[model samples]
Target chain A: MDTPLREPTYLILTALAREPMHGYAIIGEVAALSDGRLSLRPGTLYGALDRLTDAGLVELDREETVDGRLRRYYRLSPSGASILAAETERLRRNVEAATARLRARKAQALTPRTAGGLA
Target chain B: MNELERRYRRLLRAYPPDYRRERGDEIIGTYLDVAGPDRRWPSLAEAADLGRGGLRQRLRAAGATDLIPGVRLAGLLALTTAAFLAGFWVFAEQQLPPAEAGVPVFGPFVSVGIVAWCGWLIAALVVAVAPGRPARVAIGVALLMTAAVPAVSVLAGVPRPPLLVLAPMVALGVLALAVDDGLPVLARVLPVTAATVGGFLSYAMGVGAYWGAYRGGGGEFQPPIGTVLLLVVLLLAIGLGMRRDARGGWAAMALLTPVGLLNVHLLAGAVDGLASGAPRPTYPTMVGVALAVALLGPALLPAAVALRRRLGTPSAAAPCPTCGRHR
Candidate 1:
């Protein structure tokens, strides 16, 4: 089985799922997605991008010059999309399990207790 | 260029030149985009991250990712082996009877051996609790002390440890310095502790057997069952540990090389004694037979792993869809 995607890699793929985005845009999107809990520096982001590209999970979509500076856009490959979907399903199941357990505990707490047992 | 741009470029020099040429502009653009208008310098955390990233890229470029883990495991195993051997030597010497009247109890060679053994013991302790740099320094000092044993023995014209024993100890000391910084403290401590205990027990049994033979007027000493069992258990553990991946296989090979060499030496001695019509050197013969398992054992696992991987991979005869070349 494939290993689960790390949060940064997952968020980067999610950002590119909407449209191919440049490095800075993906960084901003990832930060916003995580509610500002993660702010990827240029080096870290490029490192992850390099690894993903080598793994055939990400590809260079285009390159452009903005205000005399180069910007390279990256997009998720088909394999990356399928892997991300599987990871999302795994996380959703975990969340559902936790939520169900917490709901049951809350319901039990709210019930009126008899002398020796739950009412 | 502005101050921030110049500094960021300087930091980018940490990367390989080819990588810098390819992605320098894009990386610099991202940094500039993230920087505020008033910012003049790169943050410390950013510099550290870039440095780490650059090192990772260099390692990847060198194809060292697979070997580094193996080398690290070799280091841990080597440290354990050295400590075990040193403990064995010290405990065995302690088992020797006191010198007769008007004779020195410990020879110069034995004294030097004890010092070297103590150095290895201290090094094992320091490596368990200390961080990388200090652990490396400790291993270095212990290696130097171990080398001094043969040197001092040769100069003083005293009986010294065989090269088969000293060479492995020295090699292990050097390998131990290759330990990775990321390994937990407990992982480093457990093996050394276990080996030290095993060493003491083996030597105690061997020396006890030697004394028993002398007392019974036996012509030759019998090899201790405990020591033979210890070696067997060590080889078994290494073999079992190697069933996982090529990394484990590589580690097993590194750790076993010394043991294999010693086995070869023992086998040669046994063969020579038989050829010369000497009373069959029972100890070397027995030990040689027991340790012979290590000689060709470690190589098999890695070879199998490689073969399996080769069989599972697609044939190179297939043409690449994009480039129209063999993949």
Candidate 2:
């Protein structure tokens, strides 16, 4: 499975990692997770959904009646979960490296001005 | 339900033809079901948004190969340009050194030049509508001849006038001959009205200045040659401006005629030992201004007629470089 995914795709996969839901429900979940930082236009949403479907990481699970309208539910496949895990691991490694560097820089700043070091 | 379906149907039009062919009805049905009574009639803003999107999609689907429609549009534009130019030329010609003035023999040549140009424009339109290898070749050849023929005629001492005058004259005449191309009439109307208004304003200014000088006991004013030339140029520019097919910014520049000429006159008058201020409106000066205005008035018809033809047809938008598609 391809481990790297676009941020939006990763978020969508993360949302579906819990349970299958329709397009609108998934949009709401993603918005909730992002604290309303992201909003999707219908065209963009559908276009992205189409591309994701072709990638096989996401699949249409079922059709449901929502407010008396037909809605297709989507779910992340097992391969999607593995890809999400890999992305998380990659993020974790970057964070660890950055944190270590920040701690070393902090210690160095605290060491006060020394004539020998300046020279 | 009906209104919602209609709205959805309208929205579905934004899709390409192939997409519409496959899923138009389904998409509308789906949208109707989703929207239900909650949304009801679409808002005016939404409708406009949908229309713009749909038009873009339709254009994209139509692709760049639809030269036929554009050619038809161009034909109409050609007619409008021709009509406007012709009217402007006729109206402006009266200001030219009258044949009786014995300035030169460029007078008769101007009229003939206009007629011949009109003939070429008519031929171009016929060819545009009935385009093919032969028609294309004919149009190309005609355009070449139209460009070259006048130069030859002039060089051979056939009395061809300068292109500054000939350009507008030919444009208007050609538009007239191609009037059948079905360009929108308003394209010519708006510009003519604008140009007319501008010309009238300049004339009015000239007259008012004359009246002021006449009353002020100022020195006798003589209309400068540049002023006369500027007036003539503006009259023709007005005709050009009247057409939608005319270049943008052209109409605005036409209004600047008086300002331009005044600037030239202001400098030249001082250099030539005249007063350092503006030209005073004396009897002879008023007469010159009035005469120039009157002479230009007759060209309105030919200008309108030519502008009408050109405006009826417009050109295609610039082509996209990457896609080789017209916008």
Candidate 3:
């Protein structure tokens, strides 16, 4: 892929990774998972779902109604799981690399110069 | 249904009929799921998002491009067209004295026209970036404002450009349906770029042809630039079509190849009329020339390319590609 998964796409797939969730549930779940960092509107969320479904990363799991509203549940497909895992690993590696560099810098800063007090 | 739900349903009709049929209820259900019972209307942000989304889907389904690319194409075309016009005026202002000039009338329109052109480019950017209903409307309005020059000129009996007329009309249609959505990037930009370049060059060269052919003032006037640009575009399109199965190539050809032919048609008629100091192509030969170019020119290139490709194929003797045999 020319680009990594966008934040919303990544989060949407993450929400479905746990279980099949309907539209409203996915919206709430994404918000909660992101600690309210991302709030997907209905239009934006649905458009993403369509794109994901078309790409075979997500698929409709079931349909139901609660309180007279149509609810179409979606789940991550096997391919989606594979993609999520790969993305997670990629993110983890990036995080680790940055953390390692920061730790090394901190240690270097704290270390006293052997030759002089302020070389 | 309550008033809000009914109103929302009306708004949802903006989506393509098939798309709305597929997911309209699901979308509406989502909207209501999130909305409070007391909420009477969708928020402006919500409406804009929905409008953009619907237009995006419609454009995606129709054009061979997605939303961003479509927007990019629109932004570029808008900017380019604006620049082309500005450059023309700059050239006119610099090269010729006010008392004697061969360019179109820019006298009264200089005030609003310049600002409108600037806003036109800005509106194009807005349409490209937002793709919302308001943005489209804004762009369309700006285009119409800039286009008022030609429109008024036509009403007051002055020569006007066809591109200025068609660009806004087509742009409005594109704004309504969207310019891009599901197609590839080139599928988005190629046809747009070709048409803009063709239009720009043709408009200039057509006027040039008119001036040179009839104005009793020509020691050395370069032949219409649009003619050469059209031939190059046509050949490039054919070459691409021959090499790869690309809708964009053919689409570009369809858009780009016509300008020079059109300019020829206009110039042919312009000469016959202007030489007599009458602004009508009344002669039969002039009418015939215009008719031939209008009828034959656009179709001729693609047909020729397709025919050449068909003939070049080694397996015409075999059964057809899809069916068992040719009819």
Better of 1 and 2 by lDDT: 1
Native contacts retained by candidate 3:
0.59
Which regions of candidate 3 fall more than 4 Å away from where they truly are? A6-8, A29-40, A85-119, B14-22, B43-78, B81-85, B96-113, B116-145, B150-327
Give candidate 1's TM-score.
0.50
Candidate 1: regions farther than 4 A off: A1-119, B1-65, B96-109, B152-160, B206-244, B270-327
Error of 3 at A55 (Å): 1.6
DockQ of 2: 0.02
**TM-score versus the correct structure, for each prediction:** 0.50, 0.34, 0.54
B276-298 in candidate 1: lDDT tens per residue?
55444455554464355444544
lDDT of 2 by residue, A16-118 (tens): 8999866666767878888887654333444455446645667768765654455667788777677788898898899999999999999999987867885
**Could you arrange the candidates by lDDT from highest to lowest?**
1, 3, 2
* Model 3: per-residue Cα lDDT over A12-110, one tens digit each: 999999999988889999999999988898878887887787677887787787877788888898999999999989999999999999999999999
Higher TM-score: candidate 1 or 2?
1
Error of model 2, residue B326, in angstroms: 35
DockQ of candidate model 1: 0.32
Local error of candidate 2 at B301, Å?
A: 43
Question: DockQ of each candidate's interface versus the true one?
Answer: 0.32, 0.02, 0.32
Residue B206 local lDDT, model 1: 73
Give candidate 2's whole-model lDDT: 0.46
- lDDT of the candidates, in the order given: 0.66, 0.46, 0.56
Best to worst by TM-score, what's the order?
A: 3, 1, 2
